[model samples]
Target: MNTFAHIKPIAQYNKVSYYSVCIEGNEISLFEEFITHHTSTNKKKLNHVLDWIKLIGNKYGAQSHLFRPEGETADASALPPKGIERKPHYTEYGKKKANNIRLYCLRANENVVFLFNGDIKTAHYAQDCPNVRKHFKLANKLTKAIDSAFANKDIVWNDDCTEIDCEDDFKLQF
Candidate 1:
């Protein structure tokens, strides 16, 4: 079993510093992969998605959005939020429409988040999009892996929740 830990600070905004994680054998972190792949593929749309992430990290901290209603995407009270229902240990972060690139992450702690993967959604629900569906399935599997890591003491957090002590080769199995 492998573990997860904060590797290094990737970005900082408004006093909040975002860290990156690397599963053993991978040179780039999951966050780096998302930015690189998504930006290269669709700069205009994914830019907004990335900006939203930065804004959230700056204004209310990395975990602020998690405090909102689990399924609520915006302030609209009449219409339901687009996208599929998120599962335990996973949260979707991104805007709608062209900005509908959703990044699924695991809340390792109050201020620590481990981004697993993302998908571009083109429907009212993620299940309607093959790509989004695949990412969602991957997120579920990663969630289970994280759970098992915790159970086996493969993942451990520092007292302040600002850091983690993880074993090598922490990559997701499937």
Candidate 2:
């Protein structure tokens, strides 16, 4: 179990991406606690990310899909190319090219928390982001404290339609 899974740090804003991190204990409801606690100061940052995720989840969950475990096959049906099945795809208006987006969901005691809305091209190195990596280390330490509690769990797809609105102010470091 990678301790990184426990780290659920809320996202900081940028022109292009939305991100969050967490490194809490793997107790039954720890995942829920992390998201509930670390909301972006600015609601927009929060809502934007949440809405983007909901947008795609709603798109796919409305259909028959497969949820593949992380360590097994990267069976991402929603994204383009489809995990090594990379190819050029076209959208309805030809406005957006079909690039693969990897929205991987992590499961913690059935909550299936940690919503990432990045594409395959970007996701390839998401786990290595400097900000994310810092919390990743923190989550690692937390997992060590908990005797590495993530040994047993299954990844699942979540489409609960989470709604987050933009905030007046948002802060990244606390």
Best by TM-score: 1
Give residue 161's lDDT in candidate 1 (0 to 100).
58
Q: What is the C-alpha lDDT of each candidate?
A: 0.53, 0.32
- Cα lDDT of candidate 1 equals 0.53
TM per candidate comes to: 0.63, 0.28
TM value for model 1: 0.63
Off by over 4 Å in 1: 1-26, 64-98, 169-174
lDDT per residue as tens, model 2, 95-157: 434333333443222222334333223343434554333333343333233222232212112
Give the clash count for model 2. 23
As a whole number from 0 to 100, the lDDT of residue 6 in candidate 2 is 31
- CA RMSD for every model? 8.2, 12.2
